[model samples]
Every structure is written in C-alpha cells, then in structure tokens.
Target: MNTKIEKLEHILTAFYQEKQIPAHLSAATVYSLMAGGKRIRPLLFLELLEGFDVELTPTHYLVAASLEMIHTGSLIHDDLPAMDNDDYRRGKLTNHKQFDEATAILAGDSLFFDPFYVLSNADLPVEKLVKLIQELSFASGSFGMVAGQVLDMDGEGETLSLAQIEQIHRLKTGRLLTFPFVASGIIADKSEIDLEKLREAGEAVGLAFQIRDDILDVTASFEEIGKTPGKDILEEKSTYVALLGLDGAKNQLTEKLSVAKKLLTELGITDRSDIFKMIKQLEVK
Candidate 1:
C-alpha cells in the first residue's frame, strides 16, 4: 500500500495539473497553489482514511486538496504587506512578490472561496460531507485559524502571556491539523470513542508541529527552511521556543508526539508507520 504522503502527492499533483482555469486567474492561482510544501494537512486526512478498510478514491483527494487550498490561501494572505510581509516561502519569493500584490490578493481570495464549491460538490457520503465542511469551516473561521492569525498580527505590538501564544498556535495551526484526523473518523464510520482519540492525537501532533516550527524559525537557514528566518523574533511575536526555551520546547514536542503516536497505535493503525516517523522527524527538523 502506498504511504499517505505518496498517495496524496500523486493525487494532488494530478488534480492540480489537470485543470485549466482562465489564463490570467488560473496562472496566478496555480502559481501559488503549486508552490511547494510538505502538504501535511491533507496527508493527515489520508492517513486517517487509511486506518479504515476502504479504497482510496478520487473523491478523497478532492477533499484533501481543499485543505491545501485553504492553507495556501492563508499563507498568501499572511505574507501580505500588512501581515508577515516576507519575501520568501517554500524557498521562493512570496506570491505577492512574484505576481504583484493585487494578483496575489485575488489568488488568495480564489483559493479561499474555491474549496467550498469542491467540497459541496464532492461525492462523499452526506454525513461525511457535512462533517467535512464543519471541520474545515471551524479550522478557517474566526474562532479557529483566522482567529489565530488575527491574534498573531494583533499581538505583536502588545504584551501576551504564554497561554496566549498556545491559544494562537492552537487556532492558527492546530485547528486544521485536528480537522483531518477528526473528520477522517467521521468519514470512515468510526466510533465516537475512536473519533475522540483521533482528535486528541491530531491536536497533540499539531501543537508539536507548531513548536518545532517556532524552533526552526530561529535555527533553520533560509536555504533549508525556504523562508526568511528570525521573522518571529524580528516581528516580536511570542512562540513556544520563546516561551519554553530550546530544551523546554524540544521536551514538549517529544511529549506531544509520543502521546499522538500512542493514540494512533491504540487505534490499530499499522499502515501509518511512516506517519509516526514523520512526526518524529518534525522534532529534529
């Protein structure tokens, strides 16, 4: 069986190249959309799907890609002049810089709104469909990812507690991370207990992912990271590494990932051995 990442990349790249949007708009959209990253959110959803005795359908990738669309759109918006205002992402110039600010803005807007149509039109079970929308919606809404972005930007000029930083990461990053895991159970017809466990595991891994990211912002080079380093400190933002210190951050990352793996193993998912490895890899890099 294909590991979640391989299966997901094939699905996404195929879908991405197959479509033809309008020349101008499609050009802008595909440019940022195809801009590379780990595609982690969608892979998490697929890994959860693998836990069930089901076939990998084209419908699944469509749902997964929608998650990426939101993620990419958020990144585009996040890099705007009013936001992070960075010049690099995925080791390339940011969308706004590459295509011009207005084009980047519209591309981001297209990414944001286009996924709803795909999800609403997907072939998933109705129960699964509704929950998918609910999951993604929560991850994108004011109380979720956007809320985190809002706090992050708004917090820079103010004094915030460690609790506030966690709250920011939870909403901005953890919300989407948790969605794929939790929503997969709903799609796979898993029990409520399993659902809760998957959600918890997802949250743990997601939180760890952000902490690792915080550490990377300081330690990683631009060549390795694909983005400008020291932006967090430069921006004066609070992060796990800042709050916990390097050793403390690593410890928390290890603890959360261990808990996440525990839940995944307990759920009887053997196919996700790579997923476990991937989580472990996040701590060191």
Candidate 2:
C-alpha cells in the first residue's frame, strides 16, 4: 500500500474519533465506525485534489470524510439480514450481526448523515457549497448509488446480457466511485472541459474497479478480499465474470481505461502521465 493511503487512514481515524457521540447510539456504532477499511474512495478524492495546484482546506477534508462515512454506512447496510447478510466485514464481525438489527440500522443511518454534516460545515462560499451538496445528493441518493443498489438486487438469479450487466455495475458500483473524482474537480473549480475529462476518468476507473471486484470474487480467497469470495456465483448473481470469460472481461476494462486516457488527453490532463497510468492500472484485473 502507498504511504499516502496509510496517512489517509490515520486522518479518517482521527477525524471520526474526534467527534462527540450521542447517548442514544449503541457502542456497536462506534465499533463499526472504528473498524478499518481501505479508504479507496477518500484516497481517490485526495489524489485528484493533489493533482491540482490548489491547497486542500478543511472543506476538502470534510468532503473526503463525507465519502468515507457514506461508504462505511453502505457497508453496514449491506451486511444487514435483508442485504448480503454477511457476518463479517474487513475481517471483523459485521455491525448488525454483532449488535442488534436496530442498532445496525441506526449506525448506518448515523454514518449516512455525518457526511452531509461535514459538507455543510465546509468553509467554502455558499454558492459553491450548494453546488457541492447538489452533486453529492444526486450521486449518493435515489438517482445514483441507491438506485444502483436496487437494480443489483433485482438482477439476482437473472441471466443479464453484457450491456445489462454493465448497466447494473454502472449504477450499483460506478456512481459512488465516480463521484469523488467528479466532486474533486467541482471543489477545485476546474473548467467544464477538464471536469468532463475527470468524469470520464472516474467513470472508466470506477467501472474497472467493479470488474476487478468481480474478478477478485472468483480468484481471491476469503482471507485475501476480507469478504466471502464467489458469493456472486453462489447466489447466482449476474456479473461480468459470469457473462464473459476473465480474458474478455479484462479486455472490456482495458478498453474503458483507454477511452478514459483519451479523454484525459483531450483535456490536456494526460501530461502528468503517471496519473493517467494510475487510472489505467486498475484495468489489470
């Protein structure tokens, strides 16, 4: 892992630990909050912001935390009896299963709201904050990640076509992954052209991440991924790996990364070379 990733973990840990807790909340909520994660989403936000010449203010930290909180919330909800029903996450017993169902739900709910609280407290101007809020709302709510999750649930046991599979992943996985990148550009006040390029990079990288996840579900052992492997196959869930062979799946991911690089080139952001390389590197799965 990169040193930056380690630093980001420290930052999120310290930030979450600093917040005062409500008496009504369960200890499981704090436990879930303390449970470690890869923090890839926040790292994505941080790396994108680093690409810019501007310094990250407290507002940026809030934005990154918002994504992390929302992600942790989603993980909690995903582990509920109604969802994946897993007993463990990140090598620890899941929040809901470890506590009561109600506690789990409330923890997830609390995690969900903290991001908005962080964002609303940003030091940026009112108009910019409003725009940021709008972007976050659309990407995280019914029109974005949530909708994708619903579709993913619906696709279980169905043999979806390649396009259908892509659509499901796009919604279920891509939206949140892309938002941090999109949001970073928004916070940086990048031009429309550059912003669009960033979106292209994010969309491609996000989709690639899902494809890699599908690949990992098959190739990785449970201990490696920290989640049960082959659940997609066990549940008969439609996935890129199910529809296409591994080689074909990687090809598609590579093609998407290519387009993402092209878009970056068009926006003149490709000059950094390594950033584009990092974006493309996700295609290896």
Candidate 3:
C-alpha cells in the first residue's frame, strides 16, 4: 500500500508541476496535496480495479489522482473558519492557517475543478469519460458530500437519532468513499448486480470507517490521530459514540465491518486478508 501510494503521489506531483500557474497558487495546491494521508480512497479504487482484472492504464492513475484532489480539497475547505474551524490536519497546519483564508479557498476551488480537467483530457472513450465525470460530480456535489456537510452543520449542537447520524455520514463521508468502488465497477464494466454489490460493500465500509473515526476522536490523542481530540464533544456534535455509547459504537463498527467483509465475499473477492487487516487496524484503541 505504501509503494502504491508513493507512486500515486509521484504521478500527482508531476501532473501539478506541469501546470502553468502562479507560483503561490501552485505552492498552496501542492502543500495540501502532498500532505501525508492514508490515500485510502484511491487505493481502494486501484485495488478493486486490479482485483477485477481491469487492464491498468494511465487514465486510471489520472482518476486516482482526481479522487485525491477532491478529497484533499474537501479537507482544506472543511478546516476553514467558516466550517469546522480546525487548526491542524494530518499533523500539519490547516490550509487556511498555513495560507491566507482567501488563498486556501481558491486552492480548494481549483482542486474541485482540476479533476474535471484531468478526466476531460484522459485517453478514454467519450462515453466512459462522460460517465466517470458525472459520477464524480454527483458524489462531490449538492446531492452528495455537500449535502452531508450541510446536514452536519444543521445537526451540530443538536441531539440526533442513529438514523439521522447515518444519513449525515452516508452523505458527508460515505459518498466519497463509495466513489472509488463505484468508479472501479464502471471502469471494469461490471454487471449491474456486481456494481450494486460493490456499492453495498463500499457503503458498509464507509460507515465503519466513520464510526472508527468517531471512536478515535474520543479515545486517541491529537498526536496519535493528527487532529484535535474531543472536538465532537466540544461542539456538541452527535456521533456514533454519543448515540450508541463507546461499547455500542464498537459493536456497530464490528457489525459494519462484518457486513462489508460479507459483501466482498459475495462479490467473489479472493484474498480478503488485506481488508480484514484494515478493519482490525481500526479497532478501538
């Protein structure tokens, strides 16, 4: 996974460097993009594509880079004062803190659109390219991550039911996570049933991922998680821990992990050990 992520980073760095832009904007964009992260979204996308025996192409790497750009852009925007007001992310100063708020905002806006430019220029059939772009746009747009963010802001400082929390997460975090799986299916030209199964598995893993994140917020130190701890509690935000209690949240995480693993098995994924390992790594600290 480390090697794969490094390779993706190399590709992204080269791509960004090739762009003819002002040094400051380029520096701001590269700073956020090069920040250390798990790169889980693109890793999942590429792994699933390989698992399904899709012939790897340069276009695929572009897709992977685009996913990272979108995810990073969301993080940059999320850390702004108007949003989560976070000061640090991935153990580094937030974009808005490292750069001016205006520059950070533009950097994020640039990332949001840059993926479309990559897709448009990728060497793919027009139909497939259009479909991929549409999927990405929907996942990151008003009906998807944006909607989730809006819901999260509205639900802040309010007591929310488990269903409501799930809705918020499904939109906010789950949608982008699910993108890699869905995009993989499309790239592989999988059957509708297979694609739907991938979607189900992605959704389960996404929820589990968020549950573990909520758990980490309560249990892990800032140094360990690379972000402030207890911000959820401080902001009166409803999370799995708040709604289900610590043990209950762990149980929910376990259940979602099981569901995701089962769906992967049903999809005929052989060598699910890596998936199991990832889930174990997310176990309550």
Candidate 4:
C-alpha cells in the first residue's frame, strides 16, 4: 500500500475506535470499514488537496475518512442479496454473508450516516462545512449514485446504447468519485471555474475507473481482482464491456485517461505525475 493510504487507514481506525460503541451495530460497521480495498476515494481527496497546495489539517482527514465511510456503506449494500448478491468483496466474505441480512443492512446504514456526524463535529468554518455537506449529499443522494444504481438495476439484461451506459455510470459511479475533487475544491476555496475543471477531471477518471473495472471483470481472475470475476456477465449487467467490445472498452479507457490528464494540465497542475501514475496503474494490462 502507499504510505499515504496507510496513513488514511490509521486515521480511519482511530476514528472508529473512539466513536464506535461496543455493540452489534458497531461490530458490523467496523467489519466492513476495516475490510480493506484500495481506499481510492479518500486517497483522491488527499491527493487533490495536495495538488492544489492546500494545507492539510484535521478537518481534511475527517472529510477523507467520511468519504471512505460513505463508500463502504455503498459497498455493503451493493453486496447484499437484494443487490449484486455477491459472496465476496475485497477478498473476504461479503458483509451480508459474514453477518445476518438485517445486520448487514444496518451496517450499511450506519456507514452512510456516520460521515455526517464526523463533518458536523469538525471545526471548519460554517460556510465551508455546509458546502461540504451539500456536496456530499448531492453526490450520494437521489440525483447521483442512488440514481445510477437504480438505472443499473433496471437496465440489467437489457442492451443499452453507449450513451445510456455512460449516463448510468456517470451518475452511479462518477458522482461519488467526483466528490473528492469537488470537496477538495471547496476546502481550497477555489473559483467556480477551477471547481468545474476539477469536476471534469474527476468525471474522466471515474469513467476510466469503471471501464477498467468492466475490463477486469472479463479478463481478470477472482483471486486477482479480490471479488467475483465475470459477475457482470452472469448478472447481465450493462457495462462498458457489454456495450463496447473488450478492445473498444480499452480504447475508451485510454481516451478517458488522456482527457483526465489534459484537464489536469489545463488546471495548471505542475506535478501531474502522481495523477498520471495512478491512472496508468489502472490501465488494462
């Protein structure tokens, strides 16, 4: 793991340890949150803050952790039988599989709202905090991820156009992924134009990430990806791979990566190597 990601893990662990009560709900929450993955969202948040030359503070850590909690909550719910019905995530049993159905549901719920508590208690100024909350809510709420999920569920087993697929992913995956950059912009007090540029960069990366995921689903192994591979095919989910052939998908991913890098350049980001390296690492081998 990257040293920065390790630091994020440490911060998240401490926050949970201090705030989580000793109860079943806490246990369920901790179980999923602690189940490790790339921690991409939080890492993006911190990276963008750094890229913008913003000072890192306790509040920034809180915001990053909160983003992770929101992501974990979504994953817990996503893995439930009612959703993807997956048996494993991040190389371990799914939350619903590890615990009872109700427990998993509550765990997801806890993760969903825990971030708000963290944000509300943070010592940031009222205006910035409110903007953060609003951004978070918009990204995770009906017009964003939830909407994407709904569309995904509805589009299952159906042949969707390329634009349709993009729409579903833009809302479902892109919104939350964009949140880190958006939040970083808020914290840095960037101008509206700069924030829009960050958002465009974020959307490009998010699309690339999902396209890479779709490629991995077909090409990578269960052991390699740490979750069930070929589940998209099994579930007949609409994906970049389904809409665009594997080669086409790879091309799309490359295009998005190029767009992301270009957008970062337009933002006058001097040290874009980190962003480039991250995206390159996600490239389909």
Estimate the TM-score of every prediction.
Answer: 0.92, 0.89, 0.95, 0.95
Whole-model lDDT per candidate: 0.81, 0.76, 0.86, 0.85
Q: Which one wins by lDDT: 1 or 3?
A: 3
Tens-place lDDT digits, model 1, residues 99-152: 889988988898888888778877977878988898899888887989999888
- What is the full ranking by lDDT, best candidate first? 3, 4, 1, 2
Stretches of candidate 2 exceeding 4 Å from the true structure: 1-20, 23-26, 270-281
Residue 15's C-alpha lDDT in candidate 1?
Answer: 48
> Cα RMSD to native, each candidate?
2.3, 2.6, 1.6, 1.6
Q: Which is superior by lDDT, 2 or 4?
A: 4
lDDT tens digits, residue span 1-285, model 3: 686788789877776786587777888989999888888888888877777767667788889999899999999999999999999999999998998999999999989998888778878878788878888988899988999999999999899999999999998898888888888888888888988998888888889889999999998999999999999998899999999999999999989888877877787654622545564675664
What range of 10 consecutive residues in model 2 has the weakest lDDT sum? 268-277
Better of 1 and 4 by TM-score: 4
Ranking by TM-score: 3, 4, 1, 2
lDDT of 4 at 144: 88
In angstroms, give how far residue 129 of model 2 lies from its true place: 1.0
Pairs that collide, model 4: none
Q: Which ten residues in a row have the lowest lDDT in candidate 4?
A: 268-277
